[model samples]
Target chain A: MSIQIEELCKRYGDKVLFEHLNLRVEKPAVLWAPSGWGKTTLLRILMGLEQPDGGRVTGVGRVGAVFQENRLCRALNAVQNVALVTPDGKGDPEAIRRDFGLLGMQGAALALPTARLSGGQKRRTALLRALWAEADTLLLDEPFTGLDPAAMQQAAALLRQRCAGRSALLATHDRAAIQALGWPVLVLAGQNGPESGGK
Target chain B: MKPVWVQRAAAVLFWLAVWQCAAMAVGQEVFLVSPVAALRALVQLLPTADFWGRVWFSSGRILLGFGLGAGCSVLLAAASAKIRWVDILLSPLMQLVKATPVASFIILALVWVRGRSLSILISFLMVLPVLYGAVRTGIQSTDPQLLEMARVFRLPRMRRLRAIWLPAVLPAFHQGCSVALGICWKSGVAAEVIGLPDGSIGDALYRAKITLSTGDLFAWTFVIICVSALFEKLFLWILDRAVKRVTGEEAAR
Candidate 1:
C-alpha cells in the first residue's frame, strides 16, 4: 500500500550524499532536489539498481522506472518499447498506439524506432513505458527533460492519471511540471516534506 | 563521377589486366596461367558432375564447421562474459588457439580425426578464438544503464536478450563472423590439401599440381574463391535477416 525508505545513507568518497535520509510515499509525489544532489542516485537505489551505503528499503514491490536516460530499446518503435515491460511482453498494441497518440506521438513516431525520435518524443515514450509496465511502484528521474510546455503539461496529466493510488516518486527540477502535477514535494537536500512550492 | 559499384568493377578489371600481363611476362605454363585460361577451365569443369560433387563435399564440411564454431563461440562468450572465473580459465586456451599455426593444427588433427573430418576440425579451430573474443567483448560492452533499466522493469530473460543484449552484441558479432568466414575457408581448404581427402577439391588441386595443369589449378583456386565469397554473402544475409527479426525492425518499419 506504501513504499518506505528508512535511514538510507549514501556517499561518494568524502562527499556526503544522504546521511540517515528517510522518506515514505503513499501516493504519487515529487522528489525535488537540485542537480548533483543525488536525486538520480536516490531514485536508482529505489529502483534497486544501486545499493545504499546503509539502511534497507521495504515495500518496494514490482517497481517500474523511467531512468535519467530515455533508455528505450533503440531498435524498437514507441509501441514496442512500451510493450517490453508489460506482462509477458504482450501489451495490447492498439492501446499502446492510442497512448502514444494521446502523448502527441502519431504517424511515424509510433512506427519508427525510438532512435529516430526527437528528445521530447523519446522522453514521452519512456514515461509511457514506465506507466504501462506491470508494477506497484514507479520511480521516474527527470521525466520531463526536453519537453515543451504543452508536452510537459500533457505528460504531467498522464502521470497524475496513471500514478493514482500507486506509490510513485517523480524526481525533477522542473517547477512548472511540479505545479502541473500538484503532487506533494519531498526536498532531498533540505527537508523531506511537502512544504515547498517546488521553487 | 562514376557510381561506387562501377568504380569497384573498374578497379577489379585493372587488377586482372595487371595479372594477365604478369602471366605473359612469366611465359611458363607451370609457373603462371592466364585468367582467360583459368576461366576457360572453369567453364569446362562447370558441366561435369565430378566437379559439382567435389564442390559439395568441401562446402558442406566447411560450412558445418563454421556453423558449429559460431554457435559454440556465442555460448562460450556468453559464459565468459557472465562468469569471471570462466573468462580467466578460457583466456589461456583461446590465446593458445590463436597463436597456433593452421598447418600445425591440421597436421596434429590428422592423428586424431580421419581425413574426411580434417577440414571441419581445422575450420572449427580457426573460428573459435576469433569469434569467442568478439562476442565476449560485445557482451561485456552492453550498456550498463540499459541493463539497469531492464532490471527495474523486470524484463524476462528472452525479452532482455532481444531488446538489449542482441543489438549491442550483433555488430561486433557480425564483424567477427566476417573475419571468421574468411579464416575458416582458407584453413579448411588448406587442411583438405594437407589431408588429401578423396574426391575433395583439395584432391583435385593436388592432381592438377602433380600433372602440371596450371589452368586446372588456377581454375580450382578460382572456384574456391567463388564458393567462399558466395557462402560469406549468403551467411551474412541470413544473419542480417535474423537480427531484423529479433529486433523487430520490420514491424517497426
Candidate 2:
C-alpha cells in the first residue's frame, strides 16, 4: 500500500509552510529534507496529531513513530517500551534486547530506566520500538541523530530488516544515512518541488 | 559518633532545663507541667492495657481514613485531568472542602455520623482536597510532547498510566501526602477529642483534661505528637518506595 498526500497545506499565523504540496509514498520510502522544512510537521499531520489546514492523507494504517524526541517511558525498560505499542502483546522482547545489545547497550544499562540511559541509547531504543511495533506505516523523525557512524549503519540495516513489506517515511538530514539505507528519496527544498534521487 | 551523641544529649538537657525553669516561674503544675512529671505520668500509663488499646483504636481509624482519602484523591485527580466535565464538577466541591474549617466539619459530621466514626470522616475530608489538588496539578504538568508520543504509538491505557502518568504525578503526590498525613492526624485527633469516643486516645486526653491531671494531659499530648510523626515517617517511606518502584528511578528516595 502507498500513502498519498494531496494538496497538503499548513500554516502558522502569518507564515505559510507548504501550500498545494503533493507527495506519493510507496512501500519502504525515505522522505528527506533539510532542517526547518516542516518535515516533522508533515509527519505529525499524517499521524493525525496535527490537522493540516488543507490536506487529504490516504493509506495510513496503524502508524508507529520515533518522534523527534526520544519518548520512551522514563520508568520502563526497553522491552516494556516496545511492548506498549504492539497490539498482540507478542512483540519479541528478547529480540529487542538483542538489538539493543547489538546497538551497543549492555549490562544493567538495558534494565536501567531510560532516564538513566545516554542520549544515543535512548534514541536507539526509540527507533527500535517504532520499527518493532506492529504497524503498516512507520514515521521516523531523525531516527539516527545521536548514533555514531557504525551504530547508524547498524541501525539502518535493522530498520531495513524490520520494516520489510511495510511502508516507511523517514526524515533525516544525514545524506550518508540516506545512501546507506538505499531507500528511494523524496527531497523537499524551499517549499517548491521534491527532488527525487538514488534508490 | 560520641560527639554527635553528646550534642543530642546536651540539647535534650538544655530543653529540660528551660522547661524546669518555666515550670518553676509559673509556680503551679496546672499551668505548665514539668517534663519530669509528664514523663512520670507516661511511665505510669505505659503499664495499662487500655493505653495500647486507645493508641491502636485511634491510630487504626485515622490511618484508614488517610488511606481512603489518598486513594480516592489519586483516582479523582486522574479522572479530573482526563475529562474537563469531571474537573469542572469537582472544582467547587474541592474549593468548599478547602474553605471549610476542621472544627466545622467535625461539628457537621457529628450530626450525620456516629461519634466513633467522626475522626475517620474528618480526617478523610481534611486530606482529600490536598491530595486531589496536588495530584491534579501533577497530572496537568506532565509534558505534552510525551503524551503526543504515547498517542501516536497508541499505548495501552494501563501502560500509559504506569509509564507516563505515575512518574509525572508521584513527586507532587508524595509532597501532598506528607502534608496531608500530618493534617489527617491532627484533624482526626481533634475530632475524636470533640466526639469523645469510648476507647480512643482522644477520650483519654479528654478525661485527663476533665480531672485537671496536667501531667497526664501533657504526656498524652506528647504521645500524640510522637505517634503522628512516626506515622508520617512510615507512610512516606512506603510511598517513596512505591514511587521509586513505579518510576524505576532509585533517586526518587
Candidate 3:
C-alpha cells in the first residue's frame, strides 16, 4: 500500500509550512528537499512523532529510519545498536558484528562507545540499525551525511540491497545520493511557497 | 606527586589540630575530649569483643535497610514513570517522606518495630526519597528521540531497558546511592541512639553520654564516621564495577 497525504497543512503559529498539499508515495521513493524545507517535520508527522495541523496520512507500517540525528545509543556498540531493532528471535549479535566488518568498521572500532567513534562510524551504526529493523517501511533523513565518497557508495549499496521490494522514503540534499539510489524523486520545492526555503 | 595516603594523613592531622585547639579552649574533659584522649579511648575499646559485636550489629541492620530501600525505590520509580496513576499516587507519599523529620520517623518506628530493628526502618525511610527522586528524574530525562527509535524498532522490554534506560539512569542512580548511603548511616545511628538498641554502637555512645565519658563519645563518633565512609566506598566501588561491566558488554557486543 502507498502512503497517501491529502490536503495536508502544517503551521507553527502564524507561519505556515504546508497548506492543502497532497502527495502519494508508492514503492521505494525519495523526497528530495534542501535544508529547512520541513522534510524532517513531514517525516516526524508520518512517524507519528508530530501531529499535522490539518491533514491525513495513511498507510504507514512499522517504520524504521536513520533520523536527522544519528540517534545511536552512545554507550552501546554497533552490533548492540543493530540488534536492538532486529526482530526479537531473529537477532544475531555475531552476524551484526560481521556486517559491521563488511561495512569496513574494525572489530575494535565497533567495540567502543559511539561517543568515541568518528561521525562516519556513528552514521554507519545508525544506518545498520535501521536496515536491520523488521519494518515494512524505511525512512532515511540525510542518512549519508557523514560518509566520505567511498563510504557513501558502500552505504548506498547496503541501503539498496535492504530496501529492495520494500517501501522507502529518503530525504536528502545530495543529488549524488538521489542519482545513486535511482529511486523516483518527489521534489518538495515550491510546495511551501517562495519565501519558504525548501533548499 | 603526593601519595593518596599522605594526603589523607595530612587531612586527618589538620582536623585533629583544630579539634585539639577546640578541646584546649573548652578546658574541661567533661565538655570536650582532645583527639589524643579520643584515640586512647578508641584503642581501649577496639580490643573488646563487645565493640566488634556492636559494630557488626549496627552495620548489618543499616546496610540491610539501605539495600531494601534502593531496590524498592528503583521498582517504584519504574512503575510510576510508566503509569500516570502510579505517579499521582506516589507523589504525596514521596512528599510526606521528604518532609518528615528523621527523629519523628525513628520515634514512630519504635512503636511499631522492636528497638533493635528501629535503625533499619529509619534508614530505609531516609534512603527511599533520595533514590526515588533520582531514579525518576533519570527516567524522565532519557532522550525521547532514542526512545522513539526503540519504539520504531519494537525493541523488547528487557533489551530496551539494557540498551537505553539502564545506561541513561545508572549514573543518576549511582549518585543517589552515594548520597543515600551516607544519609542512611547517619539517620540509622541516630535512631539506634534514641532507641538504645542492645549490642549496637549507638547504645554504647548513649551510655558514654550518660556517664560523661566525652572521650568515649568522641571515639564512638569517629568509628561511626569511619564505618560510614568505608561502606560508601565499598558500595560505590561495587556499583561502579557493575555499571562498567554492563555497559562494557553492551559496547563490546
Candidate 4:
C-alpha cells in the first residue's frame, strides 16, 4: 500500500507551515527537516489528527504513530503501554517482554509505571506501542528523542526489523539517525515544499 | 516534632474543649450538652438494638441512593459527551437541580414518593448534579494529544476507555464523590426528619428534638459524621482498585 499527498497546504494565522507539499510513502522512509520546519504538523495531518487547509491525501489506512511527546499512559507500565494499542488490547505477554528486552528494557524498568520511567525508557515504550499496533502505516515523530547513542542504534535496528514491508515515515533531523536507517529521505524545505531523495 | 496525626488530634481536642466550655456557660441541659454528656449518651445508645437498627436503616437506603446516582450520572455524562442533543437536553435540568434547594425538593418529592423511600430519593437527587458536572468536565478536558494517539493507533473502544478515559476522569470522579457523599448524607437525613420514615436515625433525631434531649441530638450528629467519613474512604479506595484491575495495571504489577 502507498500513501499519496497532493498539493497539501497548511498555515497558521500568518505563517505558512506547508505550501503545496507533495510526497509519497511506498516504502519505509525518513522525513528529514530542520527544526520548526513543520514536520510534526505534516505527520499529524497524515495521521488524520488535523485537517489540511487545501489538498488531498489518499491510501493512508489505519495508522500507528509515535508522537513527538512520548504518549504512553503514565499509569501503565512499559509492557501495558505497548499492549494498549494491540487489537482488543490482547498482546501476548511473552512477545512483548522479549521485545522490551531487545530494546534494553527489562525487570523493574519494564514493570514500573511509565511516569516513573526515564526519558529514554518512555521513548522506547512509545516506539514499541506503535510497532505493536494493528496498523497499515506508521508515522514516527522524533522517535529517538532522548535515547543515548547506544540506545538510538538499538531502537533503529528494532524499527528496521518491525517496519519491514510496511509503509513507514520517521520524522527527524538527527543526521546520525538518518544514516543509521539509510532509507529514502523526504526533505521538508520551507516555502519550496518537499524535495524527495533516494539513498 | 509530632506526627501529622498527632497535631490533628491535638487540634480536635482543643476544639472539643472550647465546645465543652461553651456548653457549661450555657448552664442548661435543654439548650446544650457538653462533649462528655454526648459521649455518655452515645455509649448508652450503642448497646441498644434499636440504635444499630436505626443506623443500618438510614445507612443502607442512603448508600443505595448514592450507588444509583453514581451509576446514572456516569451513564448520562458519557451520553452527554457523545451526543450534542443529549448535552443540550440534560444541561439545563442539571443546572436547575443544582440551583434548587434540598428542602424544597424533599417537600416537593413528598407528593410523588412514599415516605419510606424519601431519603433514598433525596440522597440520589443531591448527588446527581454534582457528579454529572464533574464527569462531564473530566470527559471534556481529557488530553487531546492522548486521544489523537489512540485514534492513530486504532485502539479498540474498550482499550481506549481503560487506558485513556478512566485515568483522565478518575480524579474528577473522586473529587465529585467526595463532595457528593456529605451532601447525600445531609440531605437524606433531612428528608427523613421531614418525612419521618419509621425507625430511621432522622426519626430518632426528630424524637430527640421534641423531647428536648440535646445529648441525643449531639450523639446522633457525631454518629452521622463518623459514618459519612468512613464511607467516603472506603468508596474511594474501592474505586482506585477497580480502575487498576480494569486497566490491567494491577496484573502487570
Better of 2 and 4 by lDDT: 4
Per-residue lDDT tens digits for candidate 1, residues B1-253, read 9999999999999999998999999998789998998889999999999999999999999989999999999999999888999999999999999999999999999999999999999999999999999999889888887898888888889999999999888888888988999999999999999999998999899889999999999999999999999999888888888989888764311
lDDT of 1 at B159: 94
Give the interface RMSD values of the models in order: 1.2, 2.0, 2.5, 1.6
CA deviation > 4 Å runs, candidate 4: A7-22, A34-37, A53-55, A190-196, B248-253
Find the 10 residues in a row with the least total lDDT in model 3 chain B: B244-253
DockQ of candidate 4 is: 0.69
lDDT of 4 at B122: 93
lDDT of 2 at B250: 62
Error of 4 at B19 (Å): 3.2
Stretch of 10 with least lDDT, candidate 2 chain B? B244-253
- Residue pairs whose backbone atoms clash in candidate 4: none
> How far off is residue B184 in model 4, in Å?
0.7
Winning candidate number (TM-score): 1
Q: What is the lDDT of candidate 4?
A: 0.89
Chain A TM-score for predicted structure 2 = 0.93
lDDT of 4 by residue, A1-199 (tens): 8989989998998888878887878999998887887889988999998899999898889888899999888888898888877876869978999998998888888889899999999999999989998889999999999999889999999999988998999998788998888788887766556665853
Question: Model 3: per-residue lDDT, tens digit, A1-199?
Answer: 6778888888889877778778877787778766676888888888878889887988878888889999988887777777778877347988888777767786688778787899999999998888888887888889999998788888887788888877888888888887787778887875542233222
Residue B88 in model 3: lDDT: 99
Proportion of true inter-chain contacts also present in candidate 4? 0.82
What CAPRI-style quality would you assign to candidate 4? medium
How much is A151 displaced in model 2, in angstroms?
2.2
Candidate 2 accuracy as TM-score: 0.91
Stretches of candidate 2 off by over 4 Å are: A87-91, A190-193, A197-199, B1-14, B24-27, B244-253
lDDT by residue (tens digit), candidate 3, B80-140: 9999999999999999998999999988898999999998888899999999999998999
Give the alpha carbon lDDT tens digit for every residue of B50-85 in model 4. 999999999999999999999999999999999999
> How would you class the docking of model 2?
medium
